[model samples]
Target: MSLSFASSPFSVVCSEVSFAWPDGTTVLDGLDAAFGTGRTGLIGVNGSGKSTLLALIAGELSPASGTVGVAGEIGYLPQNLPLGTARTVSDLLGISATRSALHAIERGEATEENFTAVGEDWDVEERARAELDRLGLDGLGLDRTVATLSGGEAVMVGLAAQLLARPDVLLLDEPTNNLDLDARRRLYEAVSSWPGVLIVVSHDRELLDLVDEIADLREGGVRSFGGNLSAYEELLAVEREAAERAVRVAGSDMRRQKRELEEAHVKLARRVRYGDKMYEQKREPKVIMQERKRQAQVSAGKHRLMHEDRLSDARERLSEAEEAVRADAEIRVRLPATEVPAGRTVLTVNGLPAQQPASLEELIVRGPERIALTGPNGSGKTTFLRSLLGEGPEGLQVKIGVEGVRYLPQRLDVLDDRLSVVDNVRAFAPSASVNTVRAGLARFLFRGRRAEQPAGTLSGGERFRAVLAALMLAEPAPQLLMLDEPTNNLDMASARRLSEALEAYQGALIVVSHDVPFLRTIGITRWLHLDRDTGLTEIEPM
Candidate 1:
């Protein structure tokens, strides 16, 4: 698919832009960028100002310094979609007013006010429905309340709203975060076919791969790379390799400089000894000896200062080189105690059914089987997962053959907000001493003081890790671990960290995630899909 969009009619540019949060945390500083139409995938580690930049471009926030210039109307879909139960899809699509006006005129009230409201475009409802249908919300009418939609459905609705606006410049932040696989493909198609300037901040690999270019936000600056995510990754791999090589070379140079500095000091000391010995032996005249000693001291001082300066320069270069090499820590969990034997039965489901579109007459999870639950939004995947965990949504029965069971809900409500990460884990494993809990948390990348941070204060990725640690480190050692949409709201690095942590899990794993690539990485042995008509069915691994 062609990623190119029309140029000249749309443009967005930022020159020397600087911004900071109210708490003085710098987000963007002197960042300069431009978008002259086409899809731009905004990517970076979480908290790297990608979303902040999008906000700036969309005029949601002003830059503290510099300017953000735009030549066309902008439509923005923020990361956390503003949702209200009272709000309807029509209101969200910005067509309710027109629809009402047209309806009033059709009811024989041809008032000038209603006519003016209708304006020239009288097919607002049709357009709205068409947009929704194009985005996989075909059956969802404009009057449907936002509260009735699932997380994925809500996200798609928000996207549909933006598309209906038909703005020249579009900004989407983490657009595919809560999207199911099919919904993601629909969104990707929309993005790929966009005819205006489009900037999307997301960690969705599939969505990013459809972009024309990538804008990497890092260290309060922006770096644009041509082509999509895979291309950018290839370029980044090369850059990292070069950076590591530079670090090694600089380190070697630093050591050599230090050695030279030491040798110079030794030579200076020998010269001093020779001069003192010559003076004691009176090899030359007393005045000549004093002058010679004075010259030797000056020479030694100059040599020492030069070497010290060179060494300092080498050290600075080495530090810069090291900084260029990414050293993000990966979670390395080890939970041998949670292992389930190959022949053991972990869980059994008996006649689990949702209100509609889902039913599970019978199911059995055997051994350390890792099952990935896949389904479209509103297919009752989350509902089934919650029912399996005995959380909510009645009319479901499940038997836990295993002694230990732990479920990490999509919201990650398992951790108490007031408690520290260590304390939360300790709550689950009360028998574990503070030191032991802290040590276990370190494996989840919450080492030392990070473990002491209150759960309420953690970032999304940190919160997931904290919840995972609490679930895995419980006293009974969870043999049947269930995660509902665990990869949602996580950055690429955090998702990878999670996958790595799951590598050490020898227990039965049931993860409901839209990230198919992530499931593949974690070694999903079975795929259970919730279908609308057929209900819950086991399918071959995707």
Candidate 2:
């Protein structure tokens, strides 16, 4: 029998499903849940089983036990994307003769003769073009390679491809991670209008607030709360309080039972001795002996029950308290810095163009300042960064003062994949020995064997830390730090920690990010918005 959720109220139903990785790490245990047609937000800390849960729901992985039933077709946007570099935005949109051929095949219109004779006809090309146009990729040529596109453009292309599949459910993981403000807004609007069930995993607060329900995954289970992000947060607070109360009650009961059990044992011992002394002194021993035997049986039964109750209560209290504590703790993060003198001029730019072939006449950045580079996606944010780093046009006037500048590129292109963590750090700081490099990496949390591990095997957050470690170890330590989309793959805790470190740093900073809360926390004193239409960069107070 075929299983589909197309006509069902619940798009996904999972009953007592359990899953574990090959390495013996249990991800989900006896999980039961159902998702209806609405926007659902999945929230969890790093390695808290959020991604694994999503994969199971999307049918990418089968449950190790129980049943997972899908009621409809699903469109999944995985965290690790394998995009074809040679495919263009238009090509990714399926605007080609091949798309038409596929459509014809689906409609049973492509006969053997037609397939052989008119395979590359304009009808197919026109249909593909129309679809691409609907997705806002109208003028882009079909042959344009995807590699030339910006991060936001790449994401949009991927989203468009998934939307074209027209599935009844959509699963997206960190869809807006690298997008700028404008692109994020566009993507959000698109997802909001989607008719089917939407399950999104993201750290973006704005995106979470748009969803109808929030699913918090922790402690090997999932809990669902209705309403938007704020409402869910309120519900979480209430649940935490309730759990705390339960824990306290259990603890008190366990302590009381333990004391009673101890007291009962002492009383029973004293009674036995008193009864023995009375039996020795009395002539009517039969009645007294029978009473003593009955009394000893009652005491033994009472002690056994008390011991069992105490163990149960203690176990319950510990479990409840642990869950409550985990939920209540705030995100953890750390950032380190080196002392440096404030320089006069950090950067200067003249006639810099936005992404749409428009130009900004002049821009200037000074030292010991924090500037928030704000712009919509495809407004030349990353392009401007490249120009500042001298990778773009030669004619464009860009200059930096004598001060050292450390740049964290948006794409993490500076990392060496083949090198170990220690070697990568040493490469950046040639004067530093292996021990010094390892020590710096350790400060960033790469300890023990992890420091010797190859950079290729590290997670996204670890790689970012490795890069930061290398930057900090530089002899003169950069006086100005430029970071582009630094929080893309970071968990909530790591993002907060990095923010704290940046806030404590003495050097000048230029940051490009779409995370408003992060920007606010990191102390952005000035803001610059790049207008795509006017091709100009304007400064505004934060």
Task: Say which candidate scores most in TM-score.
Answer: 1
Q: Report lDDT (Cα) of residue 209, candidate 2.
A: 88
Model 2 weakest 10-residue run by lDDT: 327-336
* lDDT, candidate 1, 1-542, per-residue tens: 11222454338778899997554556678999887679999887755677778888888888899988887688999866767789888777778889889999999999999999999868888887888888888989778897777778888888888887889889988887667878988988889899988999888888889999898877767788889999999998999999999999999999999999999999999999999999999988999999999999999999999999999999999999999996655666565467789998888887654434444577899999999999888787877788887865766577889878888887677888888889889999998899988888888777766677777656556677788778778868778888888876567877777787787688899988888789999999888888676688777778
Q: What is the lDDT of residue 18 in candidate 1?
A: 94
Error of 2 at 328 (Å): 7.6
Q: Residue-pair clashes per candidate, as listed?
A: 0, 6
Candidates in order have lDDT scores of 0.82, 0.73
lDDT of 1: 0.82
The best candidate in terms of lDDT: 1
Error of 2 at 456 (Å): 5.2
Tell me, what's the RMSD of every candidate? 4.9, 6.4
Compute each candidate's TM-score over C-alphas.
Answer: 0.85, 0.72
Query: In candidate 1, how many Å is residue 418 off?
Result: 9.4
RMSD of 1: 4.9
Model 1, residue 74: distance off in Å is: 1.4
Residue 529's lDDT within candidate 2 is 78
